[model samples]
Target: MKAEKDKIVSLHYTLTDDGGVTLDSSRGREPLSYLHGHGNIIRGLEAALEGNEAGFSSSVQVVPADGYGEYNPQAVFEVPREQFPPNETIQVGMQVQGESPDGVLNFTVLAVNEKGVVLDANHPMAGKNLNFEVEVLEVRDATAQELSHGHVHPHGHDH
Candidate 1:
């Protein structure tokens, strides 16, 4: 089967950054499976995998735009410490969620002091190019339930 819309594609991948640092890998773990043509995987990687079949192996480079997206400096802002839970220990690198007009917003604490707390809402991988070495292991038609859910359902799943 070919990796295409409504198909389940299973693959093992090693992801790296521009500096050759290993970001993630499927070695010693179950190969990742996702529904093709959905938003289950990064856009660039999904695009690269389209039309491929099992046993295909290739290296793909995905720019920030096609991955997490470009980092926006404006996404970083400051809010009063009182906005957080009173008992919560606000610290650098801590992640927090807040409500916005758009919906729930995730922020990473950048700084904490008497002045205020600095938070950055940009995704951690934003602005970084993703390098992926992938080996396609299997490709098959997605189950009807998976198509309806817009994702791949695990084997022996209830849903």
Candidate 2:
């Protein structure tokens, strides 16, 4: 059956960046499955998979706006390491959840120094063009249980 909103969709996908770096793939494994139109995948990908049938394959380029989002310059900040819990080891490239006056946010450590740590709140995929090679393996109407639970169950079994 063709994929439709609220149905179950299963697909194998290979994702890459503009530089041709392989970001992720579903090869040599079970195809990923999820409920359609439930925010289970990126917006651009979900739109591409809509109405697709089993065995359909396509390549698509997803822009920053639809993939992750444009990098926000204001999300970068420098704060003293002492501001964190005593047990935490602050290091560059490490990801941490920071609680601000605004709200809790996930940020990546870009640089570290004796004076402070530099953190960036932008998502890793932000500001990048994504390329996807997707193949629809199956499309089926979602079960009543799955619809009620707001997710697709594997093999139509209870989750």
Candidate 3:
């Protein structure tokens, strides 16, 4: 079957940055599987894989907007140190999570000082181009259960 909405696609991919630094990959592990057109993957990658069938292989470049989105300065803010666990030692570059009105937000620590802690909610990959070398290993129609769940289940449904 071709990769389209509701189709499950299994693929091996090596993700890299513009400078060719490897970021992530499925080389030594099982191929990643996801339901097509379900937003399970990035927009640019889904667009590139659209209408393709199994056995397809290609290198795709995804801009920031299509990948993680351009970094928004508004997402960076400072919060009083008391917001975090008093016992926790906050450090720069460490990832943390905060509860917001919308939902839980993941943030990276930008700076920590006596005044407050600076956190950036933007994804770590935001504002950067992503390079993907992908090989589609298999493609098939998603089962009714998979479609209902909006994602692929590599193992039998246990959730």
Candidate 4:
């Protein structure tokens, strides 16, 4: 079967940045599986996978807009240190979840000072172009339950 809306796809991929730094990979692990055209993956990669069949392999480049999205400087802000639980340690690179106008947002700590903590709400991969080397291992029609649940169900299991 070909990858399309509501189909299930399994693929192995190695993701890298523009500088060729390895960002992620499915090597040495099970191939990633997701429902196609349902926003289970990035827009660019999903678009590229459209109409592809199992055993297909290719390298796809995805821009920030189609990936994690362009970085927003306005997403960085400082919050009073006391806002956090007193027992928690405030450290750089730590992720903290908080409520925002749009909904729950995850923020990364950029800096912590005596007065306040600087946080960035941008996704970790925001602003970077991504390169993906993909090999499609399987493609099949999604089960009615899988489609209803918005994800793939492992073999031998029913939900």
Best by TM-score: 3
lDDT per model, in order?
Answer: 0.94, 0.90, 0.95, 0.94
The per-candidate count of clashes, in order, stands at 0, 0, 0, 0
Candidate 2 global lDDT: 0.90
lDDT of 4 by residue, 88-153 (tens): 998999999999699999999999998899999999999999999999999998999988888888
In candidate 2, which residue ranges exceed 4 Å CA deviation? 100-104, 155-159
lDDT of candidate 2 at residue 98, scale 0 to 100: 71
Which runs in model 3 stand beyond 4 Å of their true positions?
none
What lDDT score is found at residue 157 in candidate 3? Answer: 76
Clashing residue pairs in candidate 4 are: none
TM-score of each: 0.95, 0.90, 0.97, 0.94
Model 1 weakest 10-residue run by lDDT: 150-159
Clashing pairs in 2: none
lDDT score, residue 130, model 3?
Answer: 97
Whole-model alpha-carbon lDDT for candidate 3: 0.95
**Taking the tens digit of each residue's C-alpha lDDT, what string does model 2 give over 1-159?**
988888899999999999899999999988899999888888988998888899999999999999899989998999987988777788889999977799998999999887888999999999999899999999988889988998988876765
**TM-score for model 3?**
0.97
